[model samples]
Target: MAETREKLLEIKNLKKHFRIDRKHTLRAVDGISFDIYRGETFGLVGESGCGKSTAGRTILRLYDASDGEVKFHGENVHARKSKKELKSFTRSMQMIFQDPYASLNPRMTVKDIIAEGIDIHGLAKNKKERTERVNSLLKTVGLNTEHGNRYPHEFSGGQRQRIGIARALAVDPDFIVADEPISALDVSIQAQVVNLLKRLQKDHGLTYLFIAHDLSMVKHISDRVGVMYLGNMAEIATSKELYENPMHPYTQALLSAIPLADPEVERTRERIIVEGDVPSPISPPSGCRFRTRCPFATDICAKVVPEFQEYKKEHWVACHLYDERYADQMKQ
Candidate 1:
């Protein structure tokens, strides 16, 4: 499924496998498919090492794909396009990384760091315009223009993240892949940054693939969400459908772990604590990659890989138990 319309990015069966040894390889992102519609926030939520970040990077072509295709605005991104063509795509898509402190270059001042992409993309024809643009972006991310002269080391972690966001927007991209943007910040600062992101998206009419392990944040910012596990998507649905009617066992397990803000709800919530460490991506389980920890796994789950298919209108799941027609048989 290629990306089309105002849909800025689409990925189909995208895979990124890393060869660990002569005989072993880790399927970091294995055949995941999804589309990011125009001006909407699509969140990817999963546990660590589940390839959420890898999927994002691979879609952006930061890592060469082992298989599958990535389309940007109706064009095949992986195809050999001209430098100008690729640059055009790059300008429309940008990423806000997980960590602000580490993602920024230590040697460069905030102004220079943000200006780097603008300069590379030649976004500004002159220094004055570049400065004005940089300052405006800085203010948009809730930082002062004067702060741009300071180095990244001079700010707190959250402040640095704000700077990182400023840098990503410097290129005036239409889509932003915000990889766990709030996870590293303090609780107090997290909401501030998130609100800033929401405001920016509203004012700029930007689209996003908001990646996070924090389910609550994903629900707050995302219009739709995809739950990934062991390099495969377990389910995809509207934020409301996913939270209220999660069908896949993995999705249910994830929601069970989220601490409800309300006291009565928290007490009533059946906290699902899946025992055992995550299965190694080195050689994921044969059928459902999540079958090892899934409570309902059976012989068929271990024998055949479940296809990610739509079970309801616009809601897709990969578990055999939710196969719709075969659901009763699976339960029996």
Candidate 2:
């Protein structure tokens, strides 16, 4: 047990590669690492196919990693833990899926859905106790006790998501991986769900790993934000630091794309549209993964892999350009 790895959940050199056709490997979550502190929301931002979901699932052991480790409360998550142990682990960590409609079972009623965790874990002693717990959870999520008798299809998209949230809360999890929880709902509903999550976190002291592309929403909710590109962490820093001074080119490009509410700011800000599609994760560029589209890429970038390291206290980046030349440019 190494010390200094504080903070609640720590992912060390986490890698998850899927073997496709037994020949080509899809490097879904390739060598990503980060630490999440207690009661803080760590937002993971990336475009589609960047393996944000894979990293979240791998952390939860929903998909066991191909390599590396996920640590929770200084315990190695990958170590051979029994079913009993895993069940115990489930009480501390949980996930809220992206699509509420698809994630929920069509056959199960809301009561069965939210109470499933409690029933499986034997948290309630009797049917009356279970019903009470279920009703309480329903009320917590802004759903009525009567709705508990109804099936998933009987509810709207937002209602289904609320049920999903209630199910996650059933276990009284300390840390939650909200895997794009608001993406499927109407734009109006998204804010309510996000607010619900925030309120839950504030009231319960819950930590979150929120994965989404709504950079604005992510920035709004997260204590810190990490940008991922092609299965690698491009940059990570506190929300304020990262937004004010995004070190990685990919992060800068992504931030640049964020439309400002003020017309004057929007007009003044220059958008960096990198030319070329994202390279295949199956056969990524040899050295710097972003070299294929990175504006600052050079000959050295094609030959040597850039190490992901911390140049500042909390900020981490994986680009070689964080060297002398780039540092001087900031002064200008």
Candidate 3:
């Protein structure tokens, strides 16, 4: 089913490095490759500082790429040099930022915030048309038309996020990068936002690159999931496949930490405790970045980097444990 769909975004060997000084260069996103299909939510999961956010930013061309290519609908995103070309791309791709409070302008009214894209894109001709469009968007995101006149400070975190979503939708974009859109909201409100995103995707024929640390929510909303560790992609698989049978040790450890609702299952389940903190990206471990914390790491892990390859039908992993050449030493 996935092979039949159109590829909306293709990221090949993508990397984003930040130079700290003359001596140090931080490898935030290091050569991660993945393709997001049209009309599907591709969830990217990792621990804090694993480069998920940096990868999203680089893909959207918010940050210049240090290496590799990001193609959106066959056109290279990073190749767009002129303001006119970038402005044209902005209409097709949009972003829903993590912090609703920081993302929206404090001085602008909710109506103005939502219609900013519309005005910039010239979607509306007259003032009355702009007002009607803003009011309609407000209603679509579960906010009333009357609320459009109010300031952003008057609304809650969830409402502000809805406004952000409405703003992204105002451009009528085909793809959106939702950078931890619900991480700041209340536990109860998180589900509401997730559901809203799902509904909007269906209504608008939208594709999403949903970035988050929450595995459960990712599984709930995403069709496929990619797990990252220390700036590299550890695994990529269908959400159900990845959660049920995680191949990479980092992915296994992350899924093990998610609390199950069933008491009996929770009590019997074995938790994978990954020891040691994540190494600094400026000077990561030689060969495999996860070797320092991986339980199954052998001498070969320090000497050789495992290639990211398909392990089992559509499930990809980058781990020496699954590499046939190191089978003898990696056997549990």
The candidate that wins on TM-score is 3
- How do the predictions measure up, each by TM-score? 0.95, 0.94, 0.98
Q: What are the lDDT scores of the predictions, listed in order?
A: 0.90, 0.90, 0.94
Clashing pairs in 2: none
Scored by lDDT, model 1 comes in at 0.90
Off by over 4 Å in 3: none
**Tens-place lDDT digits, model 3, residues 16-91:** 9999999999999999999999999999999999999999999998999999999999999999469888888989
RMSD of 1: 2.3
CA displacement after TM-score superposition, residue 60 of candidate 1 (Å): 0.7
Candidate 1 per-residue C-alpha lDDT over 128-211 given as tens digits, one digit per residue, 9 for 90 to 100: 999999998888888899998998889999999899889888888888989999999999999999998999999998999999
Q: Lowest summed-lDDT stretch of 10 residues in model 1?
A: 1-10
Ranking by lDDT: 3, 2, 1
Candidate 3 lDDT score at position 65: 97
